[model samples]
Target chain A: MRRIVVKVWEFPVRLVHWTNFLAILVLCATGAYIHWPFLSTPTTAFPYVMGWMRLAHFVAGWALLAGLLVRLYWGLVGNRYARIGTFFPYLTRQGRKSFLGVLRYYALLSPRLPPHLGHNALALTVYSGIFAVMAFQVVSGFALLGQADPSGTTYLLTGWIFSFVSNGWVRFAHYAATFVMGAFLIAHVYAMWVSDLAERDGTSGSLFSGYKYGELEEFEDFGPRPR
Target chain B: MAHDPHNPRETALEQYLESRGVDRRSFLKFCTAVTATLALPASFARKVAAAVAADDRPSVIWLHLQECTGDTESFLRASRPTAAEVILDYLSVDYHETIMAAAGHQVEEVRRHTMEQYKGKYIAVVEGGIPTKDGGVYGCIGGHSMVDVVTEVCGNAAATICVGTCSAYGGIQAAAPNPTGAVGVGELLPSIPLVNLPGCPLNAPNLTATIVHFLTFGTLPRTDSLKRPLFAYGKRIHDNCERRAHFDAGQFVERWGDPGHRQGWCLYKMGCKGPATSHNCPQVRWNDGLGWPVGQGHGCVGCSEPGFWDTMGPLYERLPNVPGFGVETTATKVGLGIMAATAAGVAVHGVAKSIQLRAVEKKEGN
Candidate 1:
């Protein structure tokens, strides 16, 4: 079978993905340090460790938010694969079938891989959920930060979150979201590797190179299927 | 200083203070203390002094329900001008249920008289949660339910002051499974301008500063969304903790009586809610700046915050569980458990996939 190289991800999508990846990494590490402060300095004068960690967390948080905004913008105007409509697998009969096929493959009840140039239905659904979690992290992060200086700009932006939930619960949700992101990171990497291995396609590499090997027919109807 | 006996405004507060043996200098110092406590500039001290020394002393009606009388006890222990001066001279406390010399029907009569005479002029100070379940039978005063009493008293007051965690945010009585359906004074009387001095036992200086602010400005000081005075309850305890350096340095007290604990390291690990609790306990201290809970080698229970009794617990744990979970479980526990399960699932799936691949390879070779 002749493999066709498909432009699955655009330049903007790849850039945002890598930036978000790095930002999430930094945020998780710094956030954990802020929560538990596992490391201790030799002297009492080293007060800036936690301070620096908090600063890094804030910077990375803003970076992630920027990355999300750019990605969301691209999702509206970018190529077929990058569009937000591609993420909702439940919207089409073919997509629903492919979702079940992918589930069957994961359950070891099927041997054949689901045919897709970009993400399979199950992968798209998981990515959609991950994005939702990321959005929550951003909101909760700002809410928690706003409490630090209630009169500042951050508070003005995020003080309304306190009206719905207490700061402690917000902190809890933030922590829970971090764990979700962490678990998603692990599963996402493993699934990407597995997909690449089983399908003999550039599934993992497509994230970096924006290209994937697939059948030529898969490129047709690239946008979301008409409901 | 000699006062003109003829002028009513000239001699009212000053004369009263002098009669209590508090001279002009002492009274001015008390005013300065109140100004400082309210986080006002040094210039505001004279304004506070003038306000307190004014002839028309504002009337205050203090009511107690479903509380331990701790707020009044803390007030009595205030160092500046003393609690007696605060009640008698500072604001002419017309009827404090705890300290008033009147008994039974006489006290009720006095309260009614003051409320009628000074309608929409006196301050209504509430010191406990108002039970609302079953017509608020859980808490009552002189056969009057707390809900009815609060509604009635606050209806004809200039402003209401919730003087403790109980009245401010329902305190411990309003904790989990709130049998009486107790709620804070703000919940009971949302329309009235209110100030919440939300401590386990309300902070004395906070109450005094709030009263002085009302007397000085003819209105309550600016409050947070929780109706707490911004000046006193603005900053988090963690922000101004004496052991904050230790927290920043990552030196936490792991256990009570440990070397780190004895050496006064951060209590972050020992379930200190200081990081989340917003109060000026560190700055103001308790019992006239003597010491606070964290200062005395104990973590803050976050008694000053709303819903603290329910949400800010497992007092010895770092974080409380997410609200909906049946059993108490920390975020770390739940997060780590889910992550561990995912890791295990991924490992098993990988092994299964590898085995299936090997079997297929063997079958193809055959």
Candidate 2:
């Protein structure tokens, strides 16, 4: 058969995705070190290992926040596939039907893979949940970081968090979120690889090249008849 | 017992302090210390002095219920210009259940008389949690339930002060499987203007300074959402810790009796709750600036925080278990366990999928 190359992921979305991925990687490392500093420097004087770790964590956190904000903004103005509405797979009847179909495919009850331009319904739901977790981390991260300098503007903004729960519980939530994101990362990558191998539709390369190979009929969802 | 408000010379505090040989200069110095302790500037010392020397000293009624008397003991042990002497000389402590000379019917009579005499003018200092289960039968004083007594006493009180962790946030008595259903004073009397000076054994200076703040300004000191004075509970213990430099340097004492512990390194890894706990144990230093829990090489138990016994426990562990699991499990353990299980499940699923794929390919070949 014939295959149609379609633009799925926009440049901005891909850029934010890559940047967020890097930020989360650094954040996990630095956050763990700060919580439990496994490494001990011979001299307590010169390097300030924990200080650098915390600084890196905070900088990466802010960077992630900036990328998230930009991506959310782009979700408003980008192509149909990049729209925020696509993330909520249960919002439409077609999307819901596709979700069930994808679920059956994962359960090994169905051998056929559903055709789609961007993310499948199941992937959309999972990514949406991951975004929610990321948002929680950003909020709680700032709350924990602001505590270091209580007199600063950040503290003023987030200090009320303590009134609701103690700092210990807040730190616990942040740590728990890391593990959640970690688990998501593992499952997400594995699923992506499996999908790329099984479908052979340039799924993995689409993230880098911003295009996916699909059946001609699938292109009809983009609106208007293709010449 | 009403005294002239116009004449400072007629005040009982001046006469009492003067009789104890506490000079005017020494009294002023005490006021200055109190002012500083309250996080007030140097100029507020004069206002404090004048307030203390005023003709009307506020009467105080101290109630002890369901407690170990540790708060009273700590109050007596307060040094650094000696809070016991200053507090005794300053306030008209008419009804203290522990220290009062009068006892039995006479003491009860005096308590009644004093409560009536100084109604809406005295400070009610509650020192322990009040049991509410079974009509508060778990705790009582002089044939009155703790709940009834607190409600009655605090009803007419100008303000109420919860002087220890028990009275502040139910402390250990309200820990898991709280059979007695003990609760903090705030929970009992939510409408009362209450101040919590929470600690395992209440910090004496906080009580003294709070009283002085009232004596000076005729109002309670500014408090946090927990009803704790901001000057004492304004910052986390970790922020002002002596070994904070070691914390920032990524140096930690991994275990007790380790080289790091010997060298006085950070105790964060040893489950020091200092980072989460807010108190002035580092700056105020228990026993007249001599030492504190961290200074003496032990982690802070976070006794001042609400539900600490229930929430901040496994004392030496980094994190407490998530509640309502019917089993004790730390957040890290649960989180990492789930992640491991997911990874294992993913691998199993992947293997199964590859087997199914090979079977499909074989079927196609046939």
Residue pairs with clashing backbones, model 1: none
Q: For candidate 2, what's the TM-score of chain A, rounded to 2 decimals?
A: 0.93
The reply for model 1, stretches above 4 Å from the true place, is A44-47, A220-227, B1-10, B79-90, B322-328, B357-366
What class would a CAPRI assessor give candidate 2's docking? Answer: medium
Candidate 1 residue-wise lDDT, B58-156, digit = tens = 688888888899988885765665533543435645788777777898888888999999999999988888899998988778888888889989988
The per-model DockQ list reads 0.55, 0.60
lDDT of 1 at A162: 84
Q: Across all candidates, what is each one's fraction of true contacts kept?
A: 0.52, 0.56
| DockQ score, prediction 1 | 0.55
Tens-place lDDT per residue, model 1, A1-227, is 44578676889999999999999999999999988878866564675687789889999999999999999999999977788998998899988999999999999887546777778899899999999999989988987777777778888888799889776777778888899898898899899878876776788788888878765555544542321
Pairs that clash in candidate 2: none
lDDT of 2 by residue, B18-131 (tens): 566665667777788878889999998889888767767778888898899898888566444353456553564588877787888888788788789989998899888889
Output candidate 2 Cα RMSD.
Answer: 3.6
